[model samples]
Target: MHKELRVAAYAVCVRDGQMLLARWVARDGGKRWTLPGGGMDHGEDPYDTVVREVEEETGYTVEPVALLGVDSMRRTHPRRLGAPVGFHGLRIVYEAHVTGGELRYETDGSTDMAAWHPLDEVSSLDRVGLVDVGLALWRERPGTGRVTGIPEHPADAGN
Candidate 1:
């Protein structure tokens, strides 16, 4: 089996009872609301990654204020033309505040749109599990930089 490791950074920007989100376009052509972040480039710092990704996806310049937590996940999936691969992902979640910039949809990117949604309505939207994880970390602010009991979203299993 093949193996791959991915490290990503995400930001939770909540303000005035709303949270900022980006619309991610999946490989299957489906879309889901997600935190404003993405995978890190080789040699990139997770902190810088979060700042850059948030701006790229949401058109908002943000300053990551706190290291919320890290979430590690593993999955197995078949490659398009090869054997099954084990994918390990380490997602760094941060609490960020918008410093500047306006809300605008991304162009020619993994995410196509950006918007702010009420925190109370987040659970009812079609979203990736990371959104919940980020929010949980933001809310609980656990000393261990981790949170538990976030259920996996069935539709997000392959993400």
Candidate 2:
């Protein structure tokens, strides 16, 4: 078995009852809405990662206002050659505010389109569990910087 650890950052940017989201392109050719963030680069701070990722995916210059919470997830799945791989992910979530930039789609990237969606309609969209987790952290602002009760899956996110 192969073991892997990934650290990433995400942002929950909400303004006037609308949340910013990016359309993630899955390996199976499906699309799902997700937060505007991604993995950290080598030697990169998670704070910088969130700012850079949000710009890349959503075409917005954002300032992380507060450290929302962290979500840790683990899973094991078979690789292409049938070898089992154990994956652990640490996601740092932030409450971000958009400062500038225009809405645009990411070209040849993990996400396709960027848009603002009404918060009330988020639950009805085809989305990954991280979306809910980020929202939960944003809404509850848990003291431990953690959230619970959301269903997570390996395929729902990646670095």
Candidate 3:
């Protein structure tokens, strides 16, 4: 089994009662809406990672204004034949705002589209866990930089 850890940065950008989100294109061509961000490059700071990822995925220049919180999740899934691969993701969340750039779709990238959606309608959208976690941190503003009360996954309901 292969095991790995990934560190990522994500942003919550809200303006005019809407939130900026990118549609992530999975390898199988399915899509899910998510916050505008991605993994941190080697040797790059999380702050810079969020800025670069937002521009890459959403074509919007963002300035991270505050450190929101952090989320850590782990899962084991199939990779090799009947073998399980373990993965852990440590995500750093930030509160950001658009500084410049126009809305555009990311070409040849993990995300293919970006758009703003009404905040009240987010619950009906198919989204990744990061979105909920980011919003929780933004709304609750836990000074400890850790968001609680949201379940990480369906399996976590039992924990």
Candidate 4:
């Protein structure tokens, strides 16, 4: 199987009518916005991974406040993973509250800058598709369910 099981987490932090996001160039040379979170190390807790990742990427300490939902979607695409590829990902989304630290870009992470982008402006910036899903889960805090029948690629690309 060419599929890799990837586990990741993300935080939705809203402040002053804006959402704090990590802006970086995705591997495809497309600028994308995402919550400050990433893959978890084996034996590491999802909550801990979000905290560690956010600190590393956005220089903010966050405490996960709610379990948004789990996205068990299979996504396939060319050059998806550093090269033409396919992927199956299980992503854990969470609602996090800022606890400590200042907002700044940390070079150690993939993002070039950490800042609050107004929610109204989200559409103007490039984004990973998951952001909308994350926002949905964040808004509803749906628990323990799978959003099924989702296609593995951009809807327009195929049947």
Model 3 gets an lDDT of: 0.85
Task: Give the per-residue lDDT of model 3 (tens digit) for 19-132.
Answer: 998988765566888888888889999999999999998888999999999898888866647688787888989999999999999998888889999999998898877789
True lDDT of residue 124, candidate 4: 76
Error of 3 at 152 (Å): 3.1
TM-scores for every candidate against the unseen true structure = 0.95, 0.96, 0.92, 0.81
Model 4 lDDT per residue over 122-149, tens place: 7676666566666666656655544443
lDDT of 3 at 49: 96
Which prediction has the highest lDDT against the true structure?
Answer: 2
Model 4 residue 34 CA deviation in Å: 1.0
lDDT by residue for model 2 (10-95), tens? 99999999999999898778888999999899999999999999999988999999999999998887777889889888999999
RMSD of each: 1.4, 1.1, 3.4, 4.4
Q: Is candidate 2 or candidate 4 better by lDDT?
A: 2
lDDT, each prediction:
0.89, 0.91, 0.85, 0.72
